[model samples]
Target: MNLLVRRLFWISFAVCGTVSLVWGHDVGEGDLKVTVLAKSSDAWDDKPLPHYPTGQPEITVLKIIIPEGKKTPLHFHSVINAAVLLKGEVDVHMPAGETKKLKAGESLIEVVDKAHWGENVGQGDAEFLVFYAGEKGEKITHVLHGDETPEAVLQEANR
Candidate 1:
């Protein structure tokens, strides 16, 4: 595991332990089923993972649900991110005409600094958790509306 992933695992472990203590339960006492869904140093498209941005490191985790038949506008992320599709399916489209269909229980190391979007291709809502590794005050996503840049989005976000 990389340093960043190790740190995140320890942090999550600490939190789980603390919560168990507070709730009068042992997190590891039950029939624990541990599984590694995905692990890679490259994006799903086989590109090498980019280096983390230098600054005060910050992590953002978001749970997004896209309703069936709904499509998100083209967007890009300036920071590194990974996601796990917890429910339903999504057809992810790249600007170069490449596409990937991610199903429930799958994971993906997302394409950073590239234009892409997703559409729900399942019978129900598509739910996923996206974890963004970035610096403090960094924008994780920038919606593209033809020729828009991340800098411009940041400027607009600050306002």
Candidate 2:
């Protein structure tokens, strides 16, 4: 019993130490750590957002910060992507689709072929983290149209 307990304790400690080291061990004291409230993995539901990892030149992780009531211009992701809501509520608009409200602790997988726009509907700013599986210089978004889409429902949703 004593030997088993000792082995378990050492194994747990080693696993935690390895995780801490691999996560973010090289940052200097003054380096800033930005947190995106939107699309945080911590909010993942039963099924984790799909991961389209393209083994290419490099992997890109992008973080976007949105102020309260602000919305991202319409765009589309070029590669397979996943977004996590880290801090606040985000209302996302999809072209030819409906608006979905994503709150902190929730994650969304963007449709590969659709244009998307997001707004911070919560009282505070929202943060979004996106991981793309593509080459570093690849363009993830192609703007189809601005908020001025002719769809009356979409226009009203924007407001």
User: Compared with the true structure, what per-residue lDDT tens digits does model 1 show for residues 66-110?
Assistant: 999998898988887888899999999987788989999998889
Largest lDDT belongs to which candidate? 1
The Cα RMSD in angstroms, rounded to one decimal, for candidate 1 relative to the true structure is: 5.1
Off by over 4 Å in 2: 1-57, 146-159
Models 1 onward score TM values of: 0.77, 0.56
lDDT of each: 0.78, 0.60
- lDDT tens digits, residue span 20-130, model 2: 443464555444454333333221222333343333333456788999989988876555556778889998886656777888877676655356688899988899877
RMSD for each model, in Å, please? 5.1, 12.7
Model 1, 94: alpha-carbon shift in Å? 0.4
TM-score of 1: 0.77
Q: What is the lDDT of candidate 2?
A: 0.60
Report the Cα lDDT for residue 104, model 1.
97
